[model samples]
Target: TPLRKWEDVERTVSLAAKELPVTDMHTHLFSADFKEQLLWGVDELLIYHYLTAEYFRYSELSYDDFWKYSKQQQAELIWQELFVKRSPVSEAASGVLTAFRRLGLDTSSRDINIYREAWKNRTASEQIDKVLAAARVKEVVMTNDPLDRSEREVWLHQGNTDTRFLGALRIDALLLNWTVASAELAAMGYQVEGEWNDGVSGEVRRFLKEWSAKVGALYIAASLPGDVRFGGRDHLTAMLEEAVIPVCLELGLPLGLMIGVRRQVNPSLKLAGDMSMKADLQLLEAVAVSHPDLQLLITVLARENQHELTVLSRKFRNITLFGCWWFLHTESMIQELTRFRTELLGFSYIPQHSDCRVLEQLINKWEHSRTVISEVLVSKYKRVYESGWLLSEEDIVRDLNEWFGGRFAVVRQNAAKTKVR
Candidate 1:
């Protein structure tokens, strides 16, 4: 079933990349059961953190006054400034246009009300299904934080009801904000103090165990700032070593680390205020070696970290590099990273994860991503084909699937098979 010509390679790779059903390995999406937590609609798309950050870049509106507006009002200003006053040329702005077109909504109207009216009759579930299907997203993993009172309330009270949603236990609080963490843990009936103790460790382990099962979490994750060092001087190191690592090791869950985020550089920007700094990639060297059996999936926000991160993944068998996160999620970065990842790592690394907060944003994110990635694939395939290699449609599809989510599954499977210690 080998394809003979360059034309076939171009044609088949494009279609396969576009049509393949992918798993979003990391997203903020909730099930329809969580109600408004499952973000969608044109308003949510317009007011996305990316667009909001860009909106404030040029808008004369003061931060306090802008925060005073309703979500719809904010979305309206964003639409007018980003879409009307200027061209919707920024990635996030153009993504709004892309999502609209993919959903079969009228982007040509340039009218926010038209998009809003189109969403009036649709249920969250309907919109989720349409969005996922449009993106060819088969499944999505959610960031579930037990220390978050609202999320924990939903988890403990009603729990997630949607079949498509899976969970990853987010331990940002456990890693960084132990004050709030211990208070939340205490309320959940786990007796722990402001410090990590034997009893406290046991309690924390118990919490992780119960909640991981409660939410069907596939892994444990935390977002750490650039200064956080894995084996060196850092406050979170002890908690990670004593609590998070052991629990993850015992439960056969891969530890997901999203590093290099420097939070609240501009408090006025809220979620958009955070920025990236070059993390000491050497920090991971010790942890990756010490816990050789445990799976470590990492993504960094700094562009400077990409080369070192990929190089370090080369040194360790257990490390799996994934995603072009945050500021690095643009199309150009995706292409650049995809090129090197393929050249150096071959197909071992995951090319991208939507990191999508809005459910409907999946449509445009993947729509744009597929186009960018497939272009890389076409060139790579041609080079290999010229080198006397021929690929069939099945081969291309399988490769695309692996880059999308199959590789992450293999990592998860390896961790699952690890004898929990």
Candidate 2:
């Protein structure tokens, strides 16, 4: 039914969008398995990799010299150089203030130690709950790396029991950089000598199966470079065709590809210095064309690729476009991308993903994104209502719920049924 009035549509959509519980589709955050790996506090917030890149523009400190400082020292330096000495005007800098304000801390204090003292009382789990409550996050999808020794040890010994932290198997090393990943696999007692072949493919499948079953993974994911192509005779493509895709199909899970990351553009800044390039959508097109049965959760880092990717999603039923990732997570970009996606694909696309490496970041990231999402929805609904469409409150709720997490929940439930059979 169509919404009776424009005021009713605006109020309904705005309320539904703001209050909806988000199942964050992709994040680099950790579970309690490696509690130390769970980053929080004002210092961690101030020294985020995004801010690190910005720090370079204003600081006299060389990258090599800055790298030598301890974590606490680096945080202090960033607070002084970027926050106190200059205006915290950029999006990354403003985010730290946002988190602080959300936590009921006084942002007026230039003293870093005072803010640190404020965070000293809460336990990690308690802080996680606080952040989630503030962000209205229902579930957080973690990037579980099986090759990482600390994370692997947790799985081997205790196993993850937390329902809130959903697992996603990150297979970038195995799929894209097998030489390094194979060595890590060999150390874990899986046999693989030289190039990829039948035996290695079997081992890769076994690894994915064991971990996926152990962690109850919602999906298998990887980040690929701009040059990544399908239909090649190369071993990487061979591994994808033979092992990765087959394992995903067998397990009845979606494959998540975060495309166009140009890793380590500045070796000194490490992960923070990572950049993006425009990836060939033709490769994605080839993959979708080749594996029509396979479901894909795709998010590209480059803004230029957004339209083409959405167009591709329109063409292929299997591909679902998700999130404005990393550099593209700005308000302007989110507004542009969300409007473009909504107009072109309707509610078929996911509007946002947290991608937060630290827990408290969930506050600012989701806060900023939800505002953009709601604004976009309001505009779209206004147009529809003007044309005499009667959208009920139930209609708005259902669409908002599905866009947030209901669809992913359905995918997970279907995968579980497949596993049982």
Candidate 3:
């Protein structure tokens, strides 16, 4: 797959997945080049770019241009202009399970293989068929926000666009955003509805519940940018309060938070100057205390010139943090990252630059480790915990005790046990 047109490249990977583990190692899989690869075998596609591309793309234009166009025109000219659309959920989910089985990459819970074998005693095809039949995909998928030209201009006027682009070039960016969202949802059997505004919390919840029932969405991706936190937007809180679980029930998509880090901020600086790290911790603690079953994924970039990726790896827990790059310069960092997240992290997408051999080697290794962790450990943990045998609170305490070399137990016991019955 030489660097050719985007669609061809995407096609090559998508088709390749049928035979082997097709890993598109890129900073962002939304590029046309990336999309071609996505269709074939994009099992475990890892996105590593700022989810804010859509915002910047649309914000580059003026509001006059933005509102001047109809929704269809806006969708086409702005949102549709960038990135490959996502594969449908049903198709994508099926493709992933099918490919995994075909490749004998059964990283599902250990019990999965046992149960599967005990039940079917059938051929591989039969096994995959059974898995597909029982498959319940809860994808928390979301698109980057693409602002219209007018919107971009407002941001620009407010010093937000921060980059330059031509007229309606911003619109092209918007189109790309919508294209990715629309295509992904359509593939998964859902039509794109406009964003919810002016709806009361109850109204919003009802809408999401109905929509979830219709689309069978298990979890939807809720992208909340850092700006919102600064401005007290509280999108995550609102979603949780209003329509979170209902939407989760309707679509079966658990609420996955797509947290964004500003690209302009140096990675090292972001880490070093991270007074807000505790804020993220507080957010997680809040979610854990409130939405016990919620899944929080904090997405950040590992772009070439940023910071100490390996050092940054030890930061979060129970959160899926992503570090992506466009070239292979970050191999060492990626390897070190695997050590940090061998158990905790889900994926690390580092697309190759000029060295396909290097990328192939690195990606093969990444895919292997990712498979083991995601399939083996994650599945086991979930199944055992969900079986209602071990209390989650106790499990957390035990893990924390182990983490603290058993010191935490004495402190926790004295604090909690001494306070009450």
Quantify all predictions' global Cα lDDT against the true fold: 0.87, 0.85, 0.32
Instruction: Please write out the lDDT profile of model 3 over residues 1-421, one tens digit for every residue.
Output: 1323434433333332222322221111121121222111221111112111232333556545644755335433322233224221221122333434434555353232332344344443343233222221111111212232223233233322111111101111111244453344344344444563434445445545554333223234443333333213544455455555444433333344433333324342221222112113344445544543343333333232123332233443323343332221233444444344434432321111111111112233333333332233334345544554443334433332232123212222222222212
**Candidate 2 residue-wise lDDT, 368-420, digit = tens:** 88888888888888877777777898989898888898767665554444442
lDDT of candidate model 2 versus the reference: 0.85
- For candidate 1, lDDT tens digit of each residue in 53-119? 9999889999999999999999999999999888988888898889888888877887889999988
Order by TM-score, highest first = 1, 2, 3
> Which ten-residue region of model 2 has the weakest summed lDDT?
412-421
Give the candidate order by descending lDDT: 1, 2, 3
Off by over 4 Å in 2: 1-5, 410-420
Whole-model alpha-carbon lDDT for candidate 3: 0.32
Where model 1 places Cα greater than 4 Å from the true spot, the runs are 232-234
The best candidate in terms of TM-score: 1
Clashes of each: 0, 7, 41
Model 3 TM-score relative to the real fold:
0.33
TM-score of structure candidate 2: 0.96
